[model samples]
Target: MLGRGSMLVSSLFPLGVSGRRAGVLALLVWALVACRRAPEVSSDEVGEESSPAVLTIDAMDNEQHVLRGGFSVEAGVFRVELYEGSVLLGEALLEEGRWSIPWQPGVGSEFLEVVAYAMAGTEIRTRLDFQRLSFTEPEGLYAAEALLALPTEPDITTRYTLDGTAPGPSSPVYTTPLVLLNKRGQPAPLSLIPTNPDTSPETWRWKPPATPPVLATVVRLQRFSGETPVGPAEARTYLIGQGATSLPVLSLVTDAEHFFGHDQGIYVPGRMHDPSPEGTAGWGTGNYMQDGKEWERPVHVEWFEETGAPVFAQNAGVRIHGSGSAALPQKSLRLYAKEDYGPESFQADFFPGHPLRDFKRLLVRTSGQDQQNSKLKDCVLQGLLRETRLALQACRPTVVFLNGEYWGLHEVRERYDEYSLASHHGLNRKKVVILEGDGLLDTGEAEDAIPYAELLAYVREHDLSVPEHFAHVEARIDVEDFIDYHVAQLYFGNEDWPENNIKFWRHRGGSATPGAGDGRWRWLMYDLDAAFARGAEANSLGRLLRDERMAEPFVVLFRGLMTSPGFRERFVARFHWHLDNTFAPERVLARLDATVELLAPEMPQHIARWRYPESEASWRDEVQRLRDTLARRPEVMRRLLQEELGSP
Candidate 1:
């Protein structure tokens, strides 16, 4: 009879281990039989209510006696069970309010659940109480080495991959704690340089870096039940005493196939190809042209501040970014946050003096057209003009790590869109209208382009010397904003503009948020990499006054506005104010020197990684050239202002 009862208990609830399966069942059956055979004591005789008795877990220690814990209850037999995420680990019956089961947990086992139930006077052993416990968090950057101790469980196997790949049965088995150490060394001198000094990136030839990058151990661990994986894989990156950097660091981890595989990889030349016009080699046609959600890949992003303390680590989506630069060796990537990936917003203060902390999208930029030049031109120009009325993308230079390999320097910038405007100026995103070069609608509805088209027509038909005619144009666009925008671009000698890279926005709704909701157009400053490339004495203002390349509407608007005395006076005054303050030789050179100092430490490894500017010496020469341009630009612009506006 006892054997039959024990068999029933074993069949009903099996303890996870095969050896303890019979033992746990027999113990529970004995406890039940003892409760039944003993004389029944009434609730009144025990001086307790007829209601069910409460159970309390007093002590638990898996290390001391395999798996054991003490419980207290009102005069009744009880049974206990321990579980690791629904997998039954052990079961036992109480002996003098204490129970013990033969079980041992794996390393890094931080959480567990224990359940208690009455064994007597219950149709079946129903759980009356349960408690969950947490030990310690087990993922972070370590100074020396990390002991990667994974949990050990029966039947469930633990596997891991050190190359940032997903773990499977064929991967290395985690039997003991792994002792991981840093494998970083000083970067070797750049042996390979771009052979053609005057060729474009599309026709340029180069090879991957010959030397390996600074190293970190990225362990991706997964537990398996039979052949199926249990839950998501766990990952941790160990820096292992890497040297600190003055700039922040970004570690991006993803599957190797997603980044380097021939057919699917975005970085490689892959299947698609376009023969270069020069016919030397194909320039711009490739798999990198792929865009949209279909091309977006999953990635784990970890950010560490300049001081080496981690800020945020989360999963996000990434896609190739930029126009022509997308085809470069180190491509720019646009990162997105969505519910499908993880969080919907990256919460952090990315730029100094910026109030908003939530960002929906960001750019991991390779400095666009300036990737091979100073690489600081775009960032420096934008930073100088941030106080102006024009909207601009904020930039923060950071070094990146792909898997465990160094990816070199890249800027983390805010992506411009309706969301960006809404965040910065507190306007309704749906009501914002953004148009690019020549009235092409970049954001909002197609109908949003109508107002700009009408404004262009109005400027072309009427003479802006008439006060009413100029007022009509002023009502449609913020004239002061236009002045500031033109001053900054013209001062920087950005030759790409008035025709290319032009962007403007306005609120479609009524006034609600001060200057932002006034339904007047405002300009955005970006892609100033072409700035300061021309000599300091370049006559950008004179070129804008009468250039055949300028579109009809832009030419008509600028020439027409200059005809008005009031408009000319305001533009001259604004230009002088900026030249004295924003573009002062001392102020501009100070910012340039500070930026160079910040990048000096990382430029060696970065130059070796990309082989750009040929060598560190050439890069420094380019930076010095830029410094000379800025130092002389203010004086040159004042002379040009007299040439264009005549004795302001």
Candidate 2:
């Protein structure tokens, strides 16, 4: 169940408390200086040898840097002063017996000092000492870029960093540059790509295993009967991870209970169920998209049902009587058969500095086909003022959302007067819900997916609610809960769903930008099949959320609407564009084409199973709808498709 990247606890840095050291020392000096004001404070009272509080900082991980360490005294009207060198930067009050400050280094190495003293009528009590802290960004330095293979072998280049810098000469560089191609893309000529790299402490090399992994070693541990057992009945069964397993994925579901199977992780077949077999593919009331009618049976998808779920090797010793199920010879279970799964730690699809740890708050998702090329959707979400209020009212400190586009928090006030989905909030003030952008192109682009310049602008705006769109929860005041869009793939290829989704989230008033740049550069970006050339890149659902770069307020409600599961946004332009392009009976299916576009790259191996009767039925129904719509106007489908799809 663990995919490409594996999550390892990996390593830690020292907690530096030097600042505390300086603070305590300064306070001693101050007490000595104020001879008359000094209130009988002796070093022997606190059982210390006139030493100040000491502070030390260590980073076990880059994400969890800040630490809550110092000891606080009783509430007193005392002035606590802090200094680095000659700079008398700031002072704080000891009001509620708590003091906290974030560490942000400027220029070179930093040393902090704190001075504390009591007010009139109050005597000095025990004081805290010095602290030492160190800071570093391991992941930042280790992050490497990989190149996906091209139909025509891409010219290899050597460069360092992903900071929008162009590739430089492979020579004159002291470091060895690495290039990569996926297992599927490994042709005979360029098969030297790193599949598996040995990752150790000094130099971590992350490479896929060369041979099949010995999945979890089966171990029978404990037994259960009626939730508890006087005796033994069935032993607990589990498969540990050694290498990797290639099991048929029956179905899959997500929840906080299982950590994707590593520690009660959630990825196994038979575990993933549609509930009704014909039930909805996702959560919520079934009529999420279709207007008047609710779907009786959930759309049957192949990958979702086949290779998406997990499979477990369960209670193997429980001998099943052949044929009959009425009764069986029950035996006592082996109570103390605890089998070790090799290692205490294993792998799940966990992200480094993972989000979604707090799964209770709001977990929203987007479903565009990356048709648009801006971060408007992200900004529109950050602009939600009422959301902050609602979250605060629920007793939750701050609100959170799966950031869709790449913009700031200004639009909440700008657009709400006209189309506010939120009810109980006045102007001028809103709660500060933490916004962490996780999905799609949160930042710059790469390869076939080049981030549009428009996305960069929306991301740059500081007046917006979210400061940035490329991050998820890491700060305390940030979102309380962090969740991901498990069913994000549903947004693709649904006639106008992607458009409708953006429209709904954005409040739907603004118009979409025309993606046309004349038909001259036919094979420029997307896979347009013009008379000049034909192309299809790895366009998927990710590009869907990235396409929210519409003009303001429109992107507002559009973001909010898509936060829901209904997915009502429709792509009128793309639908019309396809029609104008003289799309044949087969090519007229935008829904099908879009679905194919989204699923094809990731699901090339499973496309054969997608040819079920239900899928064909959906295709035919959509095809007829297209044909009949076109039959009504002047080559409606053809003209529109040719005009838009053919444009740059």
Query: TM-score for each prediction?
Result: 0.74, 0.18
Q: RMSD in Å for candidate 2, one decimal? A: 30.5
lDDT tens string, model 1, 485-518? 9899899888778788789999897584459789
lDDT of 2 by residue, 10-96 (tens): 011123422445345434444444564446857767664543433312111111222222223422223455455557556542334
**Number of colliding residue pairs in model 2:** 121
Could you list the CA RMSD of all candidates, in the order they appear? 19.2, 30.5
Q: Scored by CA lDDT, what does every candidate get?
A: 0.73, 0.22
**Per-candidate count of clashing residue pairs (backbone under 3 Å):** 1, 121
TM-score, candidate 2, is: 0.18
